[model samples]
Target: MPKRIMFTMGDIACAEGAISAGCRYFGGYPITPATEIAEWMARRMPEVGGAYVQYEDEIASITSVIGASWTGTKAMTATSGPGVSLMMEAVGLAVMTETPLVLVNIMRGGPSTGQPTRGQQGDVMQAKWGSHGDYQIIALTPASVQEMFDETIRAFNLSERYRVPVFLLADETVGHMRERLVIPDEKDIKLEYRKLPTVDPSEYLPFKPDDDLVPPMALLGTKYQFYATGLTHDERGYPSDKEEVQIELITRLNNKILKNADKIVEVEEFMLDDAEIAVIAYGTPSRSAKRAIKDVRQEGIRAGLLRLKTVWPFPERHVVDLATKVKQIIVAEQNLGQIYYMVKAAASPTPVHLMTKPAGMPQLPQEIVQMIREVHSS
Candidate 1:
């Protein structure tokens, strides 16, 4: 039987999840709402024979995690809004180089230091487009401490399997809340590592993609003498100025995740089958949405909750399908209206009601309930 334990904060559970998922390397700088993750890793990594380092800044921290990941170790880092902004360049590097690493962003208000210790989901759009380029990123959002534990493992697995960087996008309330988490045993969990070329160094080409469009990664000091460059390159990892090679490389980079979106997307539905009003949300706001739905149901209103777990490849198709059945869709988010537009676009003809609070705090259940009532009356 799996052991169940109560955690006081989501950051603690996230750290524990990384450890359980075989992450042996952690590099990060301390920041609000997410500092506990780095602190926990600092104390726990030593006991597990893993390495944890608090770098001078977020740039160095993310780059170090990428470096460690290339050495055949599962590596990860955690940060909040401003820290994530600082790591954007490194995130672009990871995507261009196809580095399998995990980044946990416990989001707070931002543009630049909007809120240090407060809660907000303003980084939803940033996670998708912060890095400059047409590359695809896999980002997951967790609503509770238990999800923080579970989704960290999934983020790592997706990073390794897809041979790309993945993001665990959490916010303040979810990062600080305590909940009972049932962690799975090692045998019960399926872990994936990047595929390595079987051929000798002389015959190996690092950027040459396999059948799955994922190239086997080579270690820096290994027998392989391959090069990794930010510029467009062919199968041999050399910098090529050829337009065709550039197109193919960019297409493959974007399509690898885009084509396999079904495998990467995850969401939860509550009373969606018969619900006339659908409440769409993620992270901490999702918890409030669930509560709001329960309250509305008690009042004989046919309401439901659609909690998104995978936020990057935004569950557009699922939202579209759900829209056909619901009379109105209410999006409750900590941000003003980041995902609200996506849900609206997905729902098309179906009306989308926005219930957003841009303040540095979690959306209250009462506020969500009020939004639902207003939408119902309208």
Candidate 2:
């Protein structure tokens, strides 16, 4: 009710944040690193007059959340890489139907459950491309326990406002680590709900977009009687087979987010005012990069960090702007180099270098500082 402060793990904080954001339904399957989210939801949902259902598998869990959302409930699910694999088809379904929901991914070492107890950032690209199709989704990478609490609430608000699935991407390191979290008072927190249709049920068009290119959603069990499907549909929510209809529908789906990227993207810059070498990182690796930058700064290296809080709209504008001022950009991630290519593409001819770590390992700050030194000398 009032401001609550405590030391908590990221996963537990995520569950509490969802409750704070007014989420009333949670449907998920337990998996490594992310299981605590479901466990906490199971215990807390009933206490909050909400429902938590543990389905047979991740596919059912995702689909259940989709169904619960149509009933005018703020619904979400949590999973890891393997569970995400099973939810891809339904992810596409949520996209086609324009369902507003949240998907929290507490990533573990993977490629087939590579290391359940270990952490990794290997799911960066998967969050963007796990589901097939030309679609856009918002993904947030929280670097600390405090961020885990704060970003989960933001994820729900974005999903509701945009009518798209938002991903809260965290790895095992962040998910399991305990740290201080401050929960603001209820009245102080900002919340957003889906825009409901103003028109009568007889005149409702479920897929009709306003000027913002986002449709006003009508709830199930209401006077509004409309159809929805994974198939390409017209503004009236009826199935359409025309090529023009396909293009029109798909284009709007992608553009709603892409056109708004400037507003949705968030990046934090540290010591970049006159830096010659820049570092870009996100999630757990961003923590390491911050420390690395501080170490290099003490050694007379003009280095800074560009930490990504919103990973999906990819923050190309920031990267491009950084390239104009910095001599080189170094990308550090706990993967084979997924985001490195993205940085290289955005900062072309700006000499982007990468420092990578394999799964089950941390990107040490000392190693990152060494890389900065090498780039400074070269």
Candidate 3:
């Protein structure tokens, strides 16, 4: 049996998870709700032969992680809303250059540091489309400290497997809550390393897509002499202003993720087989959703809960399937209908209701049960 350990906050579990995942480089600036993640990494990195550097700002911090990743090191960074805003450009750079890195955003109130220490899921949409471009980003939301450890490890593995930056999206409550987590042994977990070029340096093409749709990566100090840029480029990594090359490059970038979305999307279902009403939620709100479902079930509502572990690359197929079976779908999120819209779009013709509270506090179980009662009455 696995031993269960208690954690005071989710950020500590995230730090422990990254370290266990073989992350050796951490570059970040201090920010509220997420500052503890950096502090934990700083204190623990040296003990694990890793390095932690507090950058001058968020932009530099994210850029430094990208640079470290390009040098064949597993790198990560953590920040809050305002800091994530500052790191958007560097995130775009990571996408364009195909840098495999993990970014943890312990979300607080947004729109210019609205509430630095308060909880909010307002960054859900931002994580998907924060950067200025047409690209696919993987974002995972954890509802508990146990998930903070498991999901952070998954984020790094997905980043390395897909050659893209991955987001570990957590809010203040989930980032700060204490829970008993079962830490896995090192030998049981499988870690995916980046694929290196098998051909000689002279014949290597940096951006050449392989059979797996992921291009082989070459480290900066390696014998391979190839260039990398953000602009639309060919397989040789040279910038091209041609419309055809631009189209192909952008299409490949988007499809590489979309085509393999089944391997990326993850969710947890509870008592869904015979449920008449279903609750859709993610992050901290999902915890309330789970409890609310139990409350409604005790009241003989035949309700179930669908908790999203992967927020981005939305689980449309699963949502549609559940919608077809359930009479009503209730979406409870910290934000005011960000993911609710996607759920509605996927479950067309099925009545979808929203139970949202964006006041920097998580939705309560009673609040969700009340919404379900209102829906059933109507």
Q: Which candidate has the highest lDDT of all? A: 2
Consecutive 10-residue window with the lowest summed lDDT within model 1 = 1-10
lDDT of 2 by residue, 1-378 (tens): 999998999999999999999999999998998999999999999999999999999999999999999999999999999998898888889989999999999989988978999999998899899899899999999989999989999999999999999999998899999999999999999999999999988999999999888999999999999899999999999999999999999999999999999988999999999899999998888888889999999999999999999989789999999999999999999898998999999999999998888678778888898999999999
> What is the alpha-carbon RMSD of candidate 3 to the true structure?
1.5
> lDDT, candidate 1, residue 323?
93
1 or 2, which is superior by lDDT?
2
Cα lDDT of model 3 by residue, 67-171, tens digit: 999899899999999989999998889888899999999988877869888988899899889999899889999988888999999999999988999999999
Model 1 scores a TM of 0.96
Compared with the true structure, model 2 gives a TM-score of: 0.99
Q: Rate the local accuracy (lDDT) of all candidates.
A: 0.90, 0.93, 0.90
Q: Write the per-residue lDDT of candidate 1 for residues 28-88, one digit (tens) a residue.
A: 9999989999999999999999999989999999999989988889999999988999999
**Per-prediction TM-score, please?**
0.96, 0.99, 0.98
Candidate 2 off by > 4 Å: none
**Candidate 1, residue 168: lDDT:** 96
- Winner of 1 and 3 under TM-score: 3
From the highest TM-score down, the ranking of the candidates is 2, 3, 1
